[model samples]
Target chain A: MTQPRWLDQTEMAAWRAFLTTSHLLERRIEEQLKATAGLTHPQYEILVRLAAAPGRRLRMTELAEGVVASKSALTYQVGRLEEAGLVERTTCPDDDRGVLAVLTPAGAELLEKVAPGHLEIVREYLIDRLSREELRAMTSAMRKTEAALRSG
Target chain B: MTQPRWLDQTEMAAWRAFLTTSHLLERRIEEQLKATAGLTHPQYEILVRLAAAPGRRLRMTELAEGVVASKSALTYQVGRLEEAGLVERTTCPDDDRGVLAVLTPAGAELLEKVAPGHLEIVREYLIDRLSREELRAMTSAMRKTEAALRSG
Candidate 1:
């Protein structure tokens, strides 16, 4: 058996803090989004990504990557969103076999309507809670973490 | 429609950082736990909570609250764990109507086996990636965020 590498005081504290912050923020945001717009956070992210794209459309593979979801999960989610008249998938011109997820006008409208409440919840749980210095430090720390995770 | 209250550049940057960091870390941790120990992070958390409780047991309601799961979800999860022989649910002696989730020896053993890998991923993606000052700032920031979430 390998040694049980336990966390020291500071590391344990930081890990606990990270866990609580992430879960609480996600729960609060998801609850409000579901209550108000009937959208999950991942759905919200998908719409946001498409809305930000050059033509308000992205290839399925790109959409899946942007949302951190598998292609099949993205397909199911996009299908639901489409059934709700929020988004539509079309064949990509650039790749004959590739599909594109396009934000419908209805989806754009819904997103615009939902953005305020989403940002408000974000503010209550995060933006308004932290000092500017803390925010800066957190952003920097996360960037480093992302880099480390990507490389190793 | 209320005003959009769009985020300023710094706030936007911090928010994006938080989103990416939280999602990537969660995905990485969950993937590793699932692959190595056949345990979801929530299941691991449940085991940990039970392991720490007196007699390695806790009421179902308390378990739900501690793990941020709904009662129904907790019931289903406990049922699955019980089926797997890692945990058992029994009527609480103090309250016949309430059920207790007890960590069986197998569950405790599984948690012990999983903890080191979990902590290693946590270190790689979080603790070891940030400076001490950054970790301290993040801890304080998360505490404030949690307090704000609880109050509202």
Candidate 2:
């Protein structure tokens, strides 16, 4: 029943900025991906992770963790990808109950086709707007925040 | 069709950090809000916005813009809030076709009850982790990005 600590001016400014920036960035990314590739941001992340995996494949659970998505959500997206012939699910070699999401040639090709436009939106809206020093500071701060959230 | 400019190492690192931080932060906020108040983040945002507006009410379109939510999404969340007795929908006095979302006393009470816990998560996971200088950089960088996205 202690008094709650409120955010000071600087903290409030930073918090508001983070909220606004994140919302706008996600919306823009979603719009770009949907228009160009008919994929959601999470779906695009799935494909990118799979494309970079050792054999263009990853276990569903591992992919879910990497993408910060739930297992069920990942399964649903993988199903969509399968229907589109972009990805396939296979039995995991290491565990009977486990399944792997393998990026198909079509998925790879789509990613390759979609990546430049994706990066352009990202760079135009966010990365290119900040100075090197600002980028470094943001990276450092965000890394700290990410680590704390993961551990907590 | 010129070769798309790719991210250099620093840019890539910054971009990844932003993505991971945003995802984790959003997940944490969503989990905390749902657990504490049975509210999703967007629903909570709507309540907060209504609580701050003059007369504790705002036009639906204005609320949507303030929260960076789509009109349909805002309408859906407002509908849920109305059902929960936290908000009410009324015709805007100034405009016949416009609807206003007004926060009830119960809604304000719920926000008062919830704000402390929400701020705690934001502070613990994000604000307290950064130095003042880092926060300034983040705020400035994010502001620039927000402006660009809003204007573009």
Candidate 3:
């Protein structure tokens, strides 16, 4: 195989910093959510996605895709959510094997209760940390990265 | 309680965009690593941390802390790595309950082989996507966020 063009020293530093930051930030957010809302970040993400989707529900496959998780992982997570009464799973009318996850009133209420704290953490850790210019730069950079990865 | 300050439209947009971009970027990196090196991002992170450590080994607790994973999760991951001949576990002489994870020569070789492609993907998705100013801004913002979370 040909030698791959690797990141230079500066680029390597930035990449490592970015990875470390991303991991730590995620852990902080998840820890806060677990303590305050009794929900994992992934669980909260699922609820938020369902709430945003039409009819406040999505098919299992669609939910998996939205969350970028495997079907089995989604199933296990949704099962836990269902047991907690935060979400409901229903058989899809069009396909028996298909299941739709719906955010229940209880789930919506839980999210509503947690939104303030979650938003506050987000503000403190992410939004407030960045200046206007930094925010714009970050968004632009992320978009470029996303586009490149999509093409690659 | 006082009315909690929620993210304004602009901040909300940035937050959501950041989340989406981060998730997609992780997925892209994981896919590339899986295809090229047969290693998940978390596994690669573990290997990298061990490789960077003195003697290319660390206690289970230390490894977990370094990787920001729970003990059980780290145990499971190390088990997988051991099965793959990438790592070995040995009882610590000083601490009976403590175990050391030592990187195998095969593991070090694999890391050396995969580092170039992995760094390239990271550069493509993160470092190269930002300008010098933007990179500085991101690093600064991340540092602030990390400090805030650590202090809080």
- Between candidates 2 and 3, the one scoring higher on TM-score is 2
- Of the candidates shown, which would achieve the greatest TM-score relative to the real structure? 2
What is the C-alpha lDDT profile of model 2 across A19-58, one tens digit per residue? 9889999999999999999999999999999998999999
Candidates 2 and 3, the one with greater DockQ: 2
Q: Candidate 2 residues B60-144, lDDT tens each? A: 9999988999999998889999999999999998899999999999999999999999999999999998998999999999999
Q: Taking the tens digit of each residue's C-alpha lDDT, what string does model 3 give over A11-77?
A: 6666666666677788888989999988999899899899899999999989887776778989999
Fnat for every candidate: 0.71, 0.82, 0.64
Runs in model 3 deviating more than 4 A are A59-62, A89-100, A150-152, B89-99
Q: By lDDT, rank the candidates, best first.
A: 2, 1, 3
Docking class of 1: medium
TM-score of model 2's chain A = 0.97
* Model 2 CAPRI rating: high
Instruction: State residue A29's C-alpha deviation in candidate 3, in Å.
Output: 2.3
| Per-model TM values vs. the true structure | 0.94, 0.97, 0.84
After superposition, candidate 1 runs with Cα above 4 Å error: none
Highest lDDT: which candidate? 2
**Every model's DockQ:** 0.74, 0.87, 0.58
Number of the predicted model whose DockQ against the real structure is largest: 2
How many clashing residue pairs appear in each of the predictions shown? 0, 0, 0
